[model samples]
Target: MEPLFRLEGVVVAEADGRRRIDGLSATIESGERLAVLGPSGAGKSTLLFLLNRLLDPTAGSIFFRGRPLQAYDPRELRRSVVLVPQRATAVSGTVADNVCLGRRIHRLPCPREAVAEMLAAFGLDTGLIDRDARALSGGELARVALARAVLLAPEVLLLDEATASLDPPSAEGVLRALFAGLSARGEGERTVVWVTHDWALARRLASRMWWLERGRLSRPPEGADEAGAEGETRGTAAGEGGARR
Candidate 1:
């Protein structure tokens, strides 16, 4: 099968002359679950940024569905490729409103039956649908964000530490919902590229894995030293990338 995404020597450098993603080359096949693994400062999130066009590369090229990344209209490309960031951003509306927001914005059909089924699949009670979104807890808000994203049924879903903020059970629930949502189209019908520090979770869900360090890919399946270590594996608040609490 043809690859869904192809990167050839992709380079992303910041304004200060630092390379966030350096000379990365790889292929992401359609319907594959790829786990992007690395320590903090490894530019894992930058790769996602490049994929979604949130940050354009300083050099090299990225092709999506056999076309240059820059070839597609931003709005149209985004409609087919969705990214769910680590932080869940819920709009100030009821749960039902939040789930239907994407379809409404896209001018698509809003099927109530499908909406209710998705809510139940994510372990969300039907009663929550009429409740205020802003009043939800961290886990509840996470599910709400996921429901909105998955309902769009994007061809590719990019998750940047999406489950890192949730409690174990909640995180597990989110994972089940996500994969269930994907498999809802039949197994391996949609592609997923997830950036996560959870090695065990990666092992469980990702069919393949990539290890990045200092903006470059390393040999995988043995990327980091510890599997369950509590560490930050993405950009830091100070803009300088480092790993720790």
Candidate 2:
């Protein structure tokens, strides 16, 4: 089967001749959990933007499901390949309005039950549904963003430091709920590409991991120690839980 995405000599250069991504060739398999790790300014966020066509590359080609990204309508492509950026953002309105923005955009019905369920799944209180979105805390905003993206049921989910604002325990809980939700949707139905600096979290969530540096990709160093001693076991357990779907 064809990979979900294929990049050939992809390059993204700024007007000043700075290359954010230089000759990046890669293949992202369908339904795979891919974790991209790198230092700050390694073009991690840029890569996600490229995937969903938020930005065009200066050179080379990117294919989504075997079709050139440029061939698809940007609006249509984004509905299937959703990206949640690191910063928490909310528009002027109630939480429900923000959470159901995608549905509204697609002219789909925004059922109250579905919205409530999504908020609950993300560890958010359904009561907040009527609250002003702009009044939310940073962590709450982050969870709200996540809930919004997940509710869209996108084919591919790109997360850029999505849970960075939450505390560790809260982050874990939210992620566990996320994985459960994805599993319930059915295996191989969604692909996740997460960009994070947390090695242990990456190992726990991703089936495959890659290192991006200086606009290039490479394998993570073998035998690199995880932050926590139980990281390996937790990773295994997470995979097992997902497989049970």
Candidate achieving the largest TM-score: 2
Give the alpha carbon lDDT tens digit for every residue of 1-245 in model 1: 55799999999888898998999888987866777888898999989888989889999999998899999987788877888877877787888888888778899887878778778877789788888988887777778777887988888889888877787667766776787786574334687888888766666566667888789887544435355322322221211121111
Segments of candidate 1 deviating more than 4 angstroms: 186-188, 220-245
Candidates in order have lDDT scores of 0.77, 0.82
Q: Give candidate 2 misplaced runs (Cα > 4 Å).
A: 185-188, 219-237, 240-245
| Best lDDT among the predictions, by candidate number | 2
Give the true-structure RMSD of model 1: 7.8
Instruction: Write down the TM-score of every candidate.
Output: 0.86, 0.90
Q: Kindly give the number of clashing pairs for every candidate.
A: 0, 0
Error of 2 at 38 (Å): 0.3
